[model samples]
Target: GRISEGSGEDPYLGSAIAKAMVKGYQGKDLKNEFTMMATVKHLALYGAVEAGRDYNSVDMSKVKMYNQYLPPYQAAVDAGVGSAMTSFNDIDGIPATGNKWLITDLLRKQWGFKGFVVSDYTSVNEMTAHGLGDLQAVSAQAINAGLDMDMVGEGFLTTLKKSVQEGKVTEEAITIACRRILTAKHQLGLFDDPYKYSDTSRPKKDILTAENRAAARKIATQSFVLLKNENNVLPLKKDAKIALVGPLANDKNNMLGTWAPTGDPQLSIPVLEGLKNVAPKAKITYAKGANITNDPELASRANVFGLRVDIDKRSPDAMIAEALRNSKDADVIVAVVGEASEFAGEAASRTEISIPQSQKKLINALAETGKPVVLVLFSGRPLTIAEEFNLPINILQVWNPGVEAGNAIADVLFGDYNPSGKLTASWPRNVGQIPIYHSMKNTGRPAPAHQFEKFKSNYLDSELSPLFPFGYGLSYTTFEYSAIAVDKKKIAQDEVINISFTVKNTGDHDGEEVVQLYLKDEVRSITPPKRQLKGFKKIFLKKGESQRVTIPLSANDLKFYNSELKFVAEPGKFIVFVGGNSNAEMS
Candidate 1:
């Protein structure tokens, strides 16, 4: 479920988001009143946990790490991120919190990162469980490895002095770590005023203003991805009778999703309320079609933080019966369904990445209503909806929209805004394809296209394709790509190649399209993924309007980390692919 928190299965996209996130947090100046410092965390392959389980060991080659997993952290460093946090998992048989090769050698020296390093919650202390040593030894190891602060563990506060006195850790190393931390504090203007951000009066004046909510509403709309829209069932009529039924339809508590403990749930607008606000004329009835999950144990786990998964007093049959009863008199059924907010954050990993069986039953029943059914799916991560995809219903992935959840959803459903959010990750067909991604290498016995070949890299029960590919999203308006032109077919290592392509909005409504660029290396010292994302531009096109979008392919875009661990671009013929998504045709 950590995929929900990242840029998803590609290093290039991850790098772009990393830089943008740093810029957004740090702003132009470190001492800016409106800006705060950013911390790039996990410092290693934390997401690629074994068996897709949290806190599990991660093992992969250095080549894979440099070419795939390490670029985003490096990008964050280049963007001037202020602090770095160590991962709980070990790298090369040493816990990341105590791994000098990762923190001191690679991150600080090689990547030129000047930021202070901190450990994840109790991570330095937890290294003892990793068989490194006792609390004193692990704390000494962490300080030696360039870790500055120990969050919540107090390992540094209790043991670092003793370790330094005993000569286990050098005094100079501890001093350097302390200096780095103090430097960060000074940069944040904390020395001048220790309570700079803690003024009680600021909360009422600066937080959740009308303008702030309006901005939140707009941003939330842009984050939604339209996964599937069969027959354009969306842009629902203003006066249509809508049976708004689902566990989340009127619930505000889960609107903010996981990892947002500070947000006020009461302030969030529910889907039922948002619809009324957006389309007063639309006759919308509401019902709790099903609980997030019928299983008591699952609901208990989700409720660890709060009552996010509220099991109803009514029976499942009674709930679905009421939903059916409500839909009988409605022209359309808009079912809001997905995992509870607690289903996808830290310590939240599932073997089956699908909608809960309880909600699935409600969805199937709603589809049988013979009315136009639209699913407003809410989840922090991509869900396996293979069975639901085959249904004759439109699907919109809302992704646990924040404080303005209802209003943002209402805007997209009523065509006030066309969803322009493209997925940063791929949606798998089933749990069997757990680690499925777009940039997978084709093995020696590559599977032939559009066919089933024995002894090939193919699945007998499923296609090797994701249910929805990376960069995939649909707009109410359709687009057509053409006129792909390049300034030159060939370029030197120092030269820039200009590629331009025309995109036309062919549908009746105006919408935004994310024009993506992918590159394929014909030859390299190491094997490359079939394609890698090079660049992308989001452009708005009015009905019947065409725009020629150009993005540069720089010399650095062609380079990759070789077996010798050097960044180099091998001479070869390269293929360029430009389209709406990653599964684009060659240009």
Candidate 2:
């Protein structure tokens, strides 16, 4: 759920990934007909949405913006992303769609970004709600602010012409907006032939091919994080009797996840269907143990695009009873649970991101049967799963595993594939701790003995640590990392330090391990994070096989935006950690 599963979420984000995405989307030449222009979005801080709500306002310092958030947008711009979409939130006093300082000054003049700026869906019209202006006034303001295109709202199309005629908007701003649009069209080779994407013959060879589905299944395994596999309850026996129970057990509509308007739900194989196909010998009993939610309104919201999650006619108590009844005679209880696709992405943000109470009831009932519980969780964001930890269960986080959701999940559960995926973000202990992250800043007075330290930054109810940290994931096989060895502790300003570590597969099976490298600047001009992830490696290892991974850390890696907003790396001792996850060890 933490990973950006097939959405506009991670199109342009982090440090170098944004640049890589631009190249991947646009290819070598933007003018090439085959290449598509990528729209790098939000302009700034969409991920840091307040309370994790969609289109919520964000307030952060300039230093934090430049160091933490601004680089990705800058990178996408520098990488030549064809279009930049404005964020829904206001920057300073003006909405992003009408912020001339953001679009004209910072983006165009300062960064030398040549691409046209576009508004997010109905963002221009929504500006009136932001207390900016009515549609006609806001549209003219947006054009004056350097926005070349309006997405889905006809605000600019309807108002810009009249604003120009009335002298409310300058002819030059309109001309520039028009010129940029035409330039983008020409660069995309769309001006030559606008209806190229309307071709009828492309689907037979390219879309939904055997090779594509195979790759989807493979990547699905890679994105999975085995949260808890207590007693090795997973790697489920192919010959055992398993009860597959829950709303998501055989739902096709939820497989492709959110923002996939063109996806065909009928083509997706549900978990039950995949298990049957994967383990033909396994005795599988299936039941719609519980609806996604007890509330009909929530179900209606979730099924906006299609009925991914539906409210059952039967009562919750009856459904839970049925699930328990089904699991009584089974070797193991496999509960398919968690968020439906609509619960995430765009306006799909949740106030409570946890396993639905209805599904949780079913899961708890099944677990009470004294049978091993294997939970397959589906989500698009980090959910508060602390309640589930009290029970004996094996948790696998499979975030919207695309069209091959069933086959991929079947493969993992039955040991056809070993999960090698690591979490990209940290999971909080509870929903109240929504803003938690791995690289959080250390306090002047840190937690005293990880307990209540009065007059400190410690929480009264929750702990300082997260339930699961960034880059955390388990394997069917185990991995061990030896001590870290650096080429030299002290180096010249331009020199690089070579860090090396040995990782060995100490378990029975051959599997992949994501070896992470983290560092903490002991003292800095500004108080840095407790630890920042500098580098990582995903390597394959056979049983008892060891591999040495060497990562080169340049002085540039230690640099940060100072209080003066100048990027510099201060000379100081740094604590380096390297191991399986973000909570790496040196001792």
Q: Which lDDT tens digits does candidate 2 get at residues 140-213?
A: 88888888899999998798789989998988987888899999888777878888767788888888899999
Give per-model TM-scores: 0.99, 0.95
Worst 10 residues of 1 by lDDT: 1-10
TM-score of predicted model 2? 0.95
Instruction: Output the number of the TM-score-best candidate.
Output: 1
- In every candidate, how many clashes are there? 0, 0
lDDT of 1 by residue, 22-70 (tens): 9999998777667899999888999888998888899989999999999
- Backbone clashes in candidate 1 total 0
What's the lDDT for residue 41 in model 1?
Answer: 84
| CA displacement after TM-score superposition, residue 245 of candidate 1 (Å) | 0.6
Model 2 residue 263 distance off true place after TM-score fit, in angstroms = 1.5
lDDT of 2 at 193: 81
